[model samples]
Every structure is written in C-alpha cells, then in structure tokens.
Target: MTEEDSLRETRMPSLRIMAKNTRDVMKEPILQSILEKSILTKTQLETLLIDLVIEDEFENHISYKEKASLRSKAASRSRGVSRGAFNRTLNQARKNITRCFYTMLLLAYLGLFEFTFFSPFEELATRIEGYRRIRDTLAGKTDLSSEEIESYQSAERTILSALDSLSTSLSLKSRLSRRKTGSEIESER
Candidate 1:
C-alpha cells in the first residue's frame, strides 16, 4: 500500500474511537434515568415509533360495528335523560320568544319617540326663531302704543321663563333616573 493510504486507514480507527467516546459521554448522564423509567429496548422503541407512523398513514382503527355500538349506547343514554329535559327546553324557548317580542315593541316605541319628540336642538331653534320674528314684527309698530308693547313683552318673558324651568326640570329628571338605575344594578349584583 502507498504511504498516504496506510496513514488514512490508521486514522479511521482513532476517529471511530473518538466518536464512540463522545456518544458515551453525552448519554452517560441520561442513561440511568431512562433505564429506570422504561422497560423498552432500543429495537422496541424503534418498532413502536414505526407502528405509530403506519397507523397515521393508513388510518387503521377499531371495527365499524364497535363504533356503531358506542353511538347507540350514547343515544340510549340521551333518550333516557331527555324525557324530563324537553319541557324545560320548550318553556325556556317560549320565554325567550316572549322576551324577544317585548324587546321589539320597546325598540319600536323608542324609535317613534326619537322621530316625533326628541329633537331638542330643533325645538329650541324653532321656538327662539318664533320669538325673534315676533320681536321684529313688533319693532316698527307705531299703532301698538307703549302700554300694549309693554304687556306683550311681559307675556313673552313669562313664557320664556316657564320654558327654561321645564328644560331644567327635564334635565334633572334624566340625571336622577340614571343615578337610580346605576344604584339598582349595583344592588342586584
């Protein structure tokens, strides 16, 4: 053999020795614990991993009759228990339907109120515009005289004051209602 070929063959033995030494060093710490916990040989572990792969690939499982038997057993149990459960389910469904209908009515009422009566800014704008137009109409009048103008002004002031009082009372009522509702929910919880 050539000198280079002999040297290469000589190096392979030491290389194998080094690799085996490294493997033993790495496995030494874990070996005792694994041996204590499991009775499987290396071959048995390999076989089990192979079987799991095969099962996943092939979709192999219990017999169809066994599955049908389990399903029937489950159905029988449900039938036994559902005899008493039907009435409660029916009653709860009826109650839910009633509550849904009532909610619809309440929403309709709220929508109507919103459309007809809840335009605060528009109402205030219209009322103020009416007062302004009346004042403008009475401004250049010489036939009204001083006494009639004074009386009309007094009446306008009274009506405006009453409207302001009504707005304040409505605001307070809304605030108090919200506070009461919060307290009631807190008490219930």
Candidate 2:
C-alpha cells in the first residue's frame, strides 16, 4: 500500500472517534437546554451537525489529496468528484455550519446572561446588540474594540470550559455504567 493510503487508514479511526464524541456532545442535556432557548429547533441543529460532518470529511479528503503524490492523484481523479465542485460544496457547508454554530453560541450565551439581570427588555436589547456585533464581526463589516473582543472571548472560553467538564463527567458515567452491565452479564453467564 502507498504511504498516503496507510496514513488515511490510520486517520479514519480517529475521525470516527471524533464524530462519535461530537454526537455524544450534541445529545447532552446542557446542549439540549441551550438549543431549547435558542432560535434553532432540534431539527435545525441536526442539519447543522450533518453539514459540519460532511464539511469535515471533505476537508480531510482534500488534505489527503494535497499530501498524495502526482501518480496517486492521477489515479484517484478517475474515481473522484471534480475538485472544483467539491470545494464549492465544502465552502458552502462550512459557511452554513459556522453561521449556525455561532448563532447557537450567541443565543446560549445571551440566555445564560439574561438570568443575571432583572429587566427583560434590557436583556433582550443586550441580546440583540450582542448578536449584531457577532454578525458584523463575522461579516467583516465592523471592527470590535479591545474590551468588546475580550468580553466576547471570555464568554466563549467560559462556555467551552463548562462543556468540557460536563463532557468528561458524562463520559465517566457512561464508562462506569457499561462496566456495571458487563459485570452483571458475566455473573449471569
């Protein structure tokens, strides 16, 4: 087998594991709660996830192609889709997934932040402004001040840290539950 083929074989399992972890993370209650409070429905979230996964696969495939020798590339071209078409699809998918994820994160952050304030209108306005800033920043239409950027980055970091801790706990619980079930089955056998 070619070195590129061997590398791709080794990479597949890691990609599978990452996909599984992403699936597990999406099923998490915290994520569900956030989604409930967001503009996106469960179906929309699933669609975004699907797009993200497909984009990731396409990017990985492109990377593999970039690393392969000219002969291998020529051989693969006969079996592969047009690179230009693939790239356009990948870019579209990436944009969709990114927009959805950013919106979800902003909504979740606003939801969490709203609870600390007493006035509903004030919180609503805050959310609207935050979303505007996010949209503008993402579109490259406006530059964020240092303070604004720092606050946004801090919120993102805090949310990610919380999710990481929750994921770790959930993983441990799943592993322990599986072990318990295995032991019970062994005892019965």
Candidate 3:
C-alpha cells in the first residue's frame, strides 16, 4: 500500500471513534440546551460538533501524510458544506460556548457571595479577577508587565484550550489502541 493508503488505514477507525464521541457529547442535556439557545440550527450544530471532534483528533498526528488524509476525510464528510458557512457556524458555536460558561460562572459567583458569610467563592473570584486583569490590560487600563501578561494569557489558555487538548489526547489514545489491535489481528491472519 502507498503511505497515504497506510495512513488512512490507520486513521479511519480514529475518525469514526471521534465522530461517535462527538455525537455522544452533543447528546448531553447541557450541550443540547446550549445549542437551543444559540444561533446555530440543528444541522449547523451537528456539523460544527463533528468538525471540532475530528479536527481535535487530527491535531497532533505527526506526519503530513496523516494530516492530509484526515483533512481529506473531513472535507469529504462535510461535502457541500461551504467553507464560509462552516467557519461562521464554528465561530458562532465558540462564542456561544464561551458566553454560556461565563454566564454560569457569574451566576455561581453571585450565589456564593450572597449565601456565604465568609469568602466561599475564592476560586471563582480568582477567575473573575484574572479575567478583569486581562481585560483591563487589553483596554490599556492596566499596564501589565510582559511576564504578567504572559501569565494571564497562560491562565486563559488553560481553561477551554486545556479541556480541548485533553479531550483530543484521550480520543487519540483510545483510537490508537484500537488501531494497534486491528493491525495485530490482520498480521495474525
């Protein structure tokens, strides 16, 4: 088999698993509610979820051939989806997710502050503080040193980005093990 073929052979199962996992996540009540409240139609939400899952799975593949094959698979799967439409939907979904998260955090912060005599919302308060610091720095209200700005950036990247990276890593590992088992069985044959 050509290298491209071999890579695809290894990656197809990964892609399938990624799609399944994405579907599972999308079926969650929280996600469903988020989708309902967002601008994305049902079809657009489905497409965006699948694309995110597949893209995350393919993000860390070491070889260009593997990446290209995966991208081709994604393109074919999303056939008839205009690049502009997909990107717009994806961006909207991201904004919606972020807005939802912030709203939740705000509610939690308010509740904790209202109910507790002491400072029970320390973690949430810290997050809010960090968010404000970043916002202020960006708005030129706070003159952050380079290191401080980097620290804020790192903190911001840790939340959503880390979750995404962790999910991708977990899914890739799961699929790789399945691929190895399949390869071993084929070799035995």
The candidate scoring highest on lDDT is: 3
Better-scoring candidate (lDDT), 1 or 3: 3
Each model's lDDT: 0.45, 0.51, 0.55
- Provide the lDDT at 116 for model 1: 29
The reply for model 3, stretches above 4 Å from the true place, is 1-17, 24-41, 58-80, 112-189
Q: What's the count of clashing pairs in each model shown? A: 0, 0, 0
Candidate 1: Cα lDDT at 72: 13
lDDT of 1 at 151: 64
Give the clashing residue pairs of candidate 1, or none.
Answer: none
Clashes (candidate 3): 0
For model 3, the local distance difference test gives: 0.55
Give all TM-scores, in the order shown.
Answer: 0.24, 0.29, 0.34
lDDT string for model 3 (33-128, tens) is: 445645666655666655655666667443322322222123345423455555566577777768878976896777743443223234434654
Better of 2 and 3 by TM-score: 3
Candidate 2 runs further than 4 Å off: 36-189
Comparing 2 and 3 by lDDT, which wins? 3
lDDT of 2: 0.51
